[model samples]
Target: MTQIEENLFSEFWDKLNGATGKGFGKTVSIDQDIEFYQELKYNNGVFAAFKVHRMQNDMAARLLDENGELKSFKQWLNDVQTIADHQVEQWFRTEYDTAVERAHLAAEWRQFEREAGVLPNLEWIESTSVTPGKDHKIFWGVIRPIMDGFWNRHKPGDRWGCKCGLRATDKKPTPVSDLPAGESDEPAAGLDNNPAADGKLFSDSHPYFTDHYGSKKNILLESDKLMTKYSREEVRKHFQKELKGKSLMLQASQGLAKTISVSHQDIKTITGKPHKYNYMKNTCCYWLPQLLKKAEYMGWSPDMKGTAVPGHGDVKNWHYYRFPLNNEDSFLVVKERMNGEFRIHAIQDKEHFKENKLKNPFEKR
Candidate 1:
């Protein structure tokens, strides 16, 4: 990694230390609270480092064209990289602030809920203190129970960079017609859960960890191990080993569709990085394995990139599969090519398939 990327990793790691109150290269004091919090800090730090690495690669990819020709320096600048950075910054900012807010609000909130629980007629409006996107602004002035299911999911800090908070009021609670009942009302993949109530600062479904180096479970495990080992250098070594040209041959789970197999190099087609795919996330530096293993079959068609007689053994065909991840609007659609060798792409989900001409290319009826 370059010095700039190393700096990014350290900057994020230090920022997260505020949450767990653990010093770098220090032993856990054996205090349960500090230990638990310290583990969370390590988890967030490793995830942060993974993304910083992914972002740098994506930015570098923008420097070249599909034909392998160099692009102008100005053209190398892309919006997706910025969006990636913004999400990372927002995720970190919210995580750090949520930790602080929970500490400050815990005692007062418990006492308030204890007294307020006695009253059957209390409601709260979710007011956004910061300007939010249409997705969140739509909930402005919307009322839900002060301490109920809605608050658990729609509470302040629910979205990355969300500043929405509940304002307790005497007004009666009313349901919004536009609101869909369970399942459909979930927030974005990583933003749905409440850290204050659940003590999980990051969602398990966030693409960062879901597709992170060594996988989510492994990453968390490594993060926990880091707390005990207290070696930042070792942390980087383990993370790097699991990622970057690891020559992995991953397979999809058996189901209605034929099992699919992908290698680390095929993933490089989307971003010059072997670990990542250019899906809703930067790419599947690690999540590609999970996406393939968990994916449900969509459909198949003749490969548009090559000519093949229908039903003939030309060995040119396109296989399609859809896997739900992150959010309702951001499903990952995988397209694989078969002709002795193999290639695939995790592109935009169902909503964008048509606009991108990604929907079942030359599908056989």
Candidate 2:
């Protein structure tokens, strides 16, 4: 392999060894490992770094899950790398500059972790006692600029990744104590042992599962189709009524649709209500979970194996199996889906949801 490739290989090796122990390198100090990873993150694209970083986190999550059932770190590393490589090929394209793709992938991964309630503990988000691997910091640093570039244009609070959550519209990070039931205490690290299995993550007390679950795309599509019965203005009005004085951005972008924000209103011309207002920062829409699920269902998930767009997290994040319905509404739809019964946090069922007979309503339909 080329020197760069060899270094990448060694970085991967070190990560696996300390984490899964494929024995790719000598028992270097953590400092050495971190340094190697930094080069990999900066030199490599976001997707590569993401793939590498995710493997590390996934290993930790698994260890937590099985109570440390790992047979050997080496075996785990080999096994994980093989599987990760296969999965990466599915979403990535080979045409784009690998570096750019890496950038996008890294950003998306960070977004995903934050939305899924894992980012808080992620090396990038918080100051943990454990020093981050070089690749880990490199990956975040690379994506940080990209994220910063879009901070003002897009509601910074809203850009959390897929999987239904309040931040889809709001970018302001919520405290872990504030996250809905079953939501991870640490947003970046993911769950320890399938929090869903414990009947907590998706219970009646659960925040996002109360209203729906099948396919987010299906939900958005269905909602969009339902909107066809109305007009854009009408849909906005629907949210106005549903959100009870909340303002939403009608961003008709590609790849994803519907980035909402909650805010109070201010008055204007000859109208009953205010023309504009300060959107509530707590609730917003960055990524559509139901919509993503639908895209995944439709085989429209963006390619991750090949080259991706530059400036990760910017418009044109990922292209799914299928293209957007049109530029106006790509993989997402703009609707007040999180209203009332649909609002995840509104209907969380924590302690004894099953007893309350609040089985995942989405599972049935």
Candidate 3:
């Protein structure tokens, strides 16, 4: 990843899992017509960006060698294509599905809010959540008139993972004067409109775009398609032509003792973020080269049994290494391809290491 992706947007690269999915659910996938209609599915299974970089910058950075030389295109492409065969499927069916589902659900409810606009009053109903936001509960049962601008902004689903909604009621409207302090006065950033009023399935303020790439968020989202576009030979040509780098040794880790190939899919295993494996962010990419140079070897283990990869051979053996990230106690496991090179197996946390008795690096495996 480039310094811009690695540092300026490290949050998108380093810790995207924890706080993403905001501003997302306000719009459910729906098409506008003479009458509003929806089928409850994503706009497309793939999130395509009409404007995209096509792996010119951030991806090109990954091709650079230890000496700051760019690796031959053939080398970088082989590295990218060697990544896990089925990682994209797991993410789309799970994470992307959840995001679109939330957006659909929220948009569905907003339709109710818009239809109820003719009613004199719509009451705010704040529901429970495992992860709650600042003030949804404070306005619980708040009945404001339909014409109040407050109704146009600030609904329950306005916040990420929020379960708030507006209820239709003809009861006496709560006076604006009754709000305590500054409560319910301003809509949160990016959530200033009703999705039902606007015909988009997502609010423009979605953090998937705002917090990460701003207007260019779609570049990252369209990646699942990017991963399946090339073969090892083809992609190497891509890297060679695109990067115009020098020849590559059999292994990029010449002076280093051991090397592990970190693929785009392997990244999601570390952060649990839903992006497809087309590129790497430097935040986690640093671990790989570092592991090759200075990490303690933790030996091999039987590859976890799972569904067979459809078109790829399964690795029966796996290798592990322990390295320090800031202060995190973690292990990087590499999978062996029967006829190919070594690729990452998993990036597990301290608790996972403890459960398997791999926490102490000096402890014999």
> Which one wins on lDDT?
1
Weakest 10 consecutive residues, lDDT, candidate 3? 33-42
Candidate 2 RMSD to the real structure: 25.8
* TM agreement with the true structure for every prediction: 0.40, 0.16, 0.37
| TM-score, structure 1 vs. true | 0.40
RMSD of each: 17.3, 25.8, 21.0
- lDDT for each residue of candidate 2 in 13-114, tens digit (9 for 90 to 100): 233223211211233222223223222322222222333333344444443225656557676666567555653453222212222322233333334544
Tens digits of per-residue lDDT for model 3, 13-96: 112222123423332221221112211111221222211232234245568778898899988776655232222344223433
Q: Which wins on lDDT, candidate 2 or candidate 3?
A: 3
- Model 3 scores a C-alpha lDDT of 0.44
Q: Report the poorest 10 consecutive residues by lDDT, candidate 1.
A: 272-281
Q: What is the lDDT of candidate 2?
A: 0.27
Off by over 4 Å in 2: 1-6, 9-51, 60-67, 72-83, 86-88, 91-365
